[model samples]
Target chain A: MIGRMAAAFAAGLMLATPVLAADPPAEIKIGTLYASSGRYASISMPVHSALKLWVEQKNAEGGVYVKAFDKKVPIKLVAYDDQSNTATASTLYNQLITQDKVDLLVADSGSVLTAPAVAIARDHKMFLFDQTGTGASFFSKDNPYIALMADPVSTIWPKPVADFLTHDGPALGIKKIALLYSTNEFTGTQANAVRKFIKESGAPVEIVYDQGVPTETTNYTVIINNIRAKKPDAVIHLGYAPNDIAFLRNVNEVGVKFKWMFSIYAGLETELLEKNVGVKGLQYVYTYVPPSELDYPVNFGMKMPEFRALWNKTFPDGKVEFGFNAVAGYTTALVIEKTLSVATSLDQMELRRAVFSLSGQLKTLDGTFALDETGGQIGELTPLGQLVPNEHGHLKFVAVYPHEVATGKPVYPRP
Target chain B: MPSAIRHLLFIVVPLLVVFAILPGVYENHLMLFNFVVFLILAQGVNVIYGFTGYLPFGYVGFFGSGAYGFAMMVMHAHASAPVAVIAAGLAGMLIGLLLTPLLRLSGAYFAIANLASSLAVLHFVANPALEDITRGPYGVSLTATFNPEAAYWAALVVLALTLGVVVYLKNSRFGLALQAVREDPVSAGMAGVNVVRMRVAAWLASALIAGLAGGVYAWYVSVFFPDNVFSGTFSIFAIVFALFGGVATIIGPIVGVLILYGVYNLIGFTTPQYFQLIYGLLIMGLVLFLPAGLVSLVTRRGRHVP
Candidate 1:
């Protein structure tokens, strides 16, 4: 009788084993915001499109593997358009968290749009996959609900530029510098970093002109004339794609050429800048060497050549251009995919841990994925490079900073 | 019952009760919070443009000032959220007092001047020269003081107060005199209406309502830049909502916000791809067809709206 009773208990335990494991969800809902129009459209559309490409590719491949359920689950993307308005973005972010209850939340493209999501995500205890908002103010020791997935934090982004300016600049006869930036988080932080880096380097360079114009300032004829009066050897104008387009176009129109000109978007969004400012306008301009040009070896996701081919085929109409932001979006998608494969469950903190765990271990098309203790991205640093005209008169990047990666010598005193 | 008391019971009390109970039933408290904010702003517009006949094209200046005021008090003084909110209101009033000279202008001149003033304030706040004080476009992050629940309740209180003021204007002699000034300042002046005082009083009250709303908003978001708070959309949306519902009536702005902003959110959720086009068309149609606003449909038939 005892043997028979033990056999029956063992049979009952076997029957309940399946129930002990968590059931696989029908779909993993990922909520994010995008700006289809207004100020950020040029930068936002590419990132959003790249994210869509990843979603389609994964879904076509029967879905992604989630370790939590130990099975493949389809992705459900819940997205909203904020029209680049912060108040609207704030409302939509709250809607994504409360009403949608998505498993993962991703921020919009730029710092202006992402500012609203940081607070909203933290308030709801949802982890935010910040795409390209490199604002210095977002990361702190207290906030654990946010992590930057792409682009180095602004505090460290300009290291290559500063290093080049201080270490290699004086030898190249680039001593006097004029700094101009649009007054916003992304570029403003970069400007501050550049200033700090130069001062700390104790280089012979002296900053002759430093000024910040409003982000909405479109006319730069007066500002250009002001900078011209200082007669600096090198000029660094930190601004958005639109600001860069206006500033460069104004430079070309006004017929004043600086010896050394550096603008952020000239290399970062080369296609867009070339189309707007024309190939001649971007010639010999110094900018960051984007991931598209670097060809970083990847442990996962498509390589630069494959991704660019796919981006062109997917967006053949050419309304949006391929650039650094395009690469950034795919990098973020890879991080999410890898995180899901390793995360034990869909809990917010668990997801955060899974993300942080991949730091220094994961490599993608952008670069090695790494994060600081405060969740700021510390990897994927871009080297300072200059844009020079190739055989076909189209601009190509020539990495000139950090001598080890130096592809060519600096071209000073534009003639 | 007095007309003001009746309006309060029928309009203000029910609205407040519904909003007060909404967070428990619906999960999207931010959406509800936003609705409450627009209601206050639309009514604030009604107070000035509806009653005093001055179009505050730069109404967002006071709102932005209030937000900065709250930010300064919290960051500098380390004051609690409630005290910062009070300071925000005072900041708005101070700006209103400084611009009192604008009252000398009329019609388009007043409107353009107000708009320019708001833009001026935005530039001043965002200027990198003020980096030490305002953070100068680097943005503000108030993680320690972030209390969404308390801020939502404070917003509700501000809404209730705004509604009460509107109800008083609808029933009191002071309201009548302000409307009199709006209709014809010269005629009202001959009739001893004290045009300047009435207009300024209404303007200051309008500014205070927006200030309180802005303070609560800043407290709720807890992280923002100068651009976010100073966006011209605030002024544009408030004006559009008040105009759509037929300002001057207490319930008109509320109804307009509920219907229009509800549609706005619905479009944003359902068909976001065409949101901008559809919304633009809807506004143009409203102006072309329903020039006087939705309330005009009923008032045209010799009926009181409120």
Candidate 2:
């Protein structure tokens, strides 16, 4: 009786071994798009380059681990240039799905370029790993193939800023506000959120001057003069990197300064903004404090210090700036790696499930990876902060809002 | 065989069949759809510039207008894709009519004026004050009527119709008269060709073609911003493609789209890092070596090219 039982157990073990060790693919194909040159290049290149760097690093380590196959597999990154053209992006995205048959589909950096991928991915039933497209319209209950990887959704991005204004502004004598934004989806949605939050708060503050200029507006001297006429206590300018550079430069050139000022890119792409607007121009400007500045504790992937060092070593030329977008790209790569490790199969829906399962569980340099029901990122929120010149004469972030993360008091009424 | 029939059987039919059956064999239907869109746009450029000798630098204005026209119909009226597409064509024609005065300025002036007119339209559609209607710069999303297969077939049908128009221009007396007007408007007027009327007709027809292409494109993509449809690259590509083929001929634009666009996709897919540099060099080479376009090669040999 003992000999017969041992034979049955040995047979069961032999049958289960093959099922546990499934055949692995030779390489995991991750496809994505980027803008090499054009308006969006400043934002797109850093994200794409960071992703490329992660791919090279992993492949150097003999590849990432895949749980389904019980082995490590090399990563093959297939990227295409959209040239910042949506039609071209649409066609290339389809090629990635149909022709290249990439295992993972990642979108370009911004909302305009990523818009085409949102629809195309759904049509083809391919899951899209949206990098930093924070458009509010992209998230809906019907679409299950996408998730925001890095930035918070635009609708909620202005919460900390708005919270600072409504809760803290009345005491600081910030009675009037001026809101100026570039009329595009990312900034426009943030602008809307700011307006809603301020209105709903029922605070004593009022938006004295509210207007939107074209996204391509380079000369803001006239707009600056126009805003000065309103005499608002605090001025908020929402725009991309180039817009911020131009707006800040114009304010300095025109020799006008409001008591308080805010701009998005001043904090998000600090390196690029510093190079363009100069150190003196960004002094006392309020903006979001990115992860690179905060150095959030990580539970997975490289820590902020290590990632920054690797980035500096890899990109020695300094053509592309390292900022929030650089961190964003690597965060996305980490998510992809984790997803591949947990997914039971290479199927599209299975990949999505694995990605969603990592929500609230994965932590990296970008902060906790959390998602709303519609796949919009709810965690990794950047707190409102002010750029104050340090003793070394270089601008340093002083987190002002969301009391838990406050590093220093805001120096309001800039001299 | 009759000349028009021969051109239709040999050129148009084969092109249509290839695009129709390509989705099954080639898998990338969006690329195929884009090919068809470019083919129609190139031919549209051929119609105006080839037949009337007017270089419309802002031809994408019509395309963008058509796209918005389709969007408005779908978003506000809740019309189906086909109806919205027709509205798109009408919108293009409407803009063409509105800019009819631009034709009065000939040569470089007309081109610049057309370009300015397009930019004006772009700003108008993207203005924040009009956000309630056009959605301003926030963009439009029409997933309710999203049908890629249907939109692809619609694009194919539009391509066929555009080819028919071009073939008619290549063979009919109206075409010869339009060419005469292009060569010398005074002489053509002396010969009783109704120069103004002929120019306007060709201009409207060209606008209609682009408008239809834009509508079909919007339907296929189902989500876009104003910048996507109004991109100056569309106008530039269509003009380059039309000029690269020998223009005026039925096969010239077709050949241009096939060869130039094919090389474009090949470069874009293989080595995307050097895509812009390589494509720029290729265009420069074509301009320097084949000034009259590829059709000139056969025409220079004294052989008729369809």
Would you estimate the TM-scores of all the predictions? 0.97, 0.96
**The best candidate in terms of TM-score:** 1
- For B1-306, candidate 2 gives per-residue lDDT tens digits of 999999999999999999999988998889899899999999999999999989999999999999999999999999999999999999999999999998898899999999999988898888777878888888888989999999999999999999999999999999999999999999999999999999999999999999999999999987788878889989999988988897888898889999988988888888878888888997898799888788999999999987
Q: Model 1 chain A, poorest ten-residue lDDT window?
A: A16-25
**Taking the tens digit of each residue's C-alpha lDDT, what string does model 2 give over A100-212?**
99999999999989999998999999999999988776888989999999999998999999889899999999989999999888888899899999999999999999998
Against the unseen true structure, what C-alpha lDDT does each candidate score? 0.92, 0.92
**CA deviation > 4 Å runs, candidate 1:** A1-21
* Fraction of the reference Cα-Cα interface contacts (below 8 Å) that each candidate reproduces: 0.79, 0.64
Candidate 1 has an lDDT of 0.92
Provide the lDDT at B16 for model 1.
98
Segments in model 2 whose C-alpha atoms lie over 4 Å from true places? A1-18
Docking class of 1: high
**fnat, candidate 1?**
0.79
